[model samples]
Target: MTGMERMQMDAAEYRDNQPEAKSAVGEAYEWVESFLVPLLAFLLIFTFFARLATVNGISMLPTLHNGERLILQQAGYAPEYGDVVVVDRSITDEDAIVKRVIGKEGDVIFIDFASGEVWRNDTLLDEPYINEPTMLQYDISFPVKVPAGCVFVMGDNRNHSLDSRSSDIGMVDVRHIMGKAVFRFFPFNKFGGIS
Candidate 1:
């Protein structure tokens, strides 16, 4: 073959390989920008709205464990009594605690330390779901009416939990609440909606 013809053939081969090289690089860049970037953004949004938390202490024991993974819903809502809630204690200077709502605004709450019973407006509460049979004696037992736009929360394992019972963390402001614990996602057997 002539030298010029051979050179032209080599040039064509190089040009042919260029498109394949460019295509491989383009696929990689598109994969990252299209799939990876958006996937990470979605995760950040999900974590902000629905957090994944691991139970760290025995404060909510029996009802929740020290290592269980829980799904916390973050949207603000008026939580009803008996709903398990995840609280943001930074505003109160207490650690993050998971507790059940026991009373709401405008309700009179009385804790009978001796009987381990809670009362709302002088009516005794029937709390069969509590982990412990009796609550330890708390120093404050006066019938404190929950202030307007606040909630009274307590741990299921009442004896070990430091909750609204403490004056420092008194009634939790409705705004400081982060979300409710609506499901447990880990430890296969325990995976289900949080009661």
Candidate 2:
């Protein structure tokens, strides 16, 4: 071939090879963006901002069941009345405990065992989530004020739960709270946000 013709042929070959090189780099970038980035983000969120916990007993029956998996939000969790929380070693020798917040710091809690009523700050709580009426009484006296940075907790199953009502596990400290149970992931049939 002539010199110019050979140069043209070489240029065509170079053009043909360029797309494959660009395609490979583009594909790698796409993979990283589509998969790796999202995976890393998920890991970071779960590690720092959230956690996973499992229900161990029937104390929170009708609301939570045994072996049920839950998504707990850790960062920025503040104890609020009616929120379900997972605590860290608050109960004696127990790894963790899940209970609903009944009262916060400075709030007064009173329970009338005969009437099965729970009063918080002079207002009777209309607790529809409870498995039964609060008839089972423990050692703690009624109208007790929650100490500073502490919260009173109880299970939804009032008759069966051993919680703040009992002297065994009374008021929970704010620092002992690991996270709040926001959603239930296991037992797909009952999968939804924790009420």
Candidate 3:
């Protein structure tokens, strides 16, 4: 063959012998889309939108037990009456505490230790979720008014919990509330939405 024909044939052979370049790039792109993107999304969702917390004590017994895993909703969460929440250690020297919001800001809370009753804003609470009556009295007195940007918290296990009624952890500030417990995921059998 002529020199030009030989060069053309050599170029054609080189092209034919090489592997497809697009396949490698396409695989890399697919890996990012299928694995990396989803992993980042999952991490972001778990970090900002939700969090995992474990119940540490028997304070929330009957409603939540110790060692139970909970999923907390952090984003756009506002504490409401009767909502179970996790509080950080801003008000106490201990670690995080979990309790139910008994009263919100500006609400008057009165616990009659003699009668084992709790009254909020002069309304008697229908607390069927409490493990027992409010017979255990802490240092904080009744007829207390929840200040602005604060919440009164209590444990379901009334007699055992050291909560807002106690002076050590009295009146949790709104800023100290980490998140609201939205679901229970551990123990497999008890997996469901937290009430």
List TM-score per model, in order: 0.78, 0.87, 0.91
What is the descending TM-score order?
3, 2, 1
- How does model 1 fare in lDDT? 0.82
lDDT of 2 by residue, 97-182 (tens): 89999999999999989999999989999998999998998889888999999999999989989899888888899999999999
Q: What residue runs in model 3 are displaced by over 4 Å at the alpha carbon?
A: 1-3, 14-19, 90-93
How badly does each model clash, as a count of residue pairs? 0, 0, 0
Pairing residues by index, what is the TM-score of model 1? 0.78
Name model 2 segments beyond 4 Å from true.
1-15, 90-93
**lDDT, residue 91, candidate 2:** 49
lDDT of 1 by residue, 46-164 (tens): 77677766776887867898888888887556678888887787764766778789899999998877778889889998887787754665555568889988999888888988778
For all candidates in order, the CA lDDT equals 0.82, 0.92, 0.93
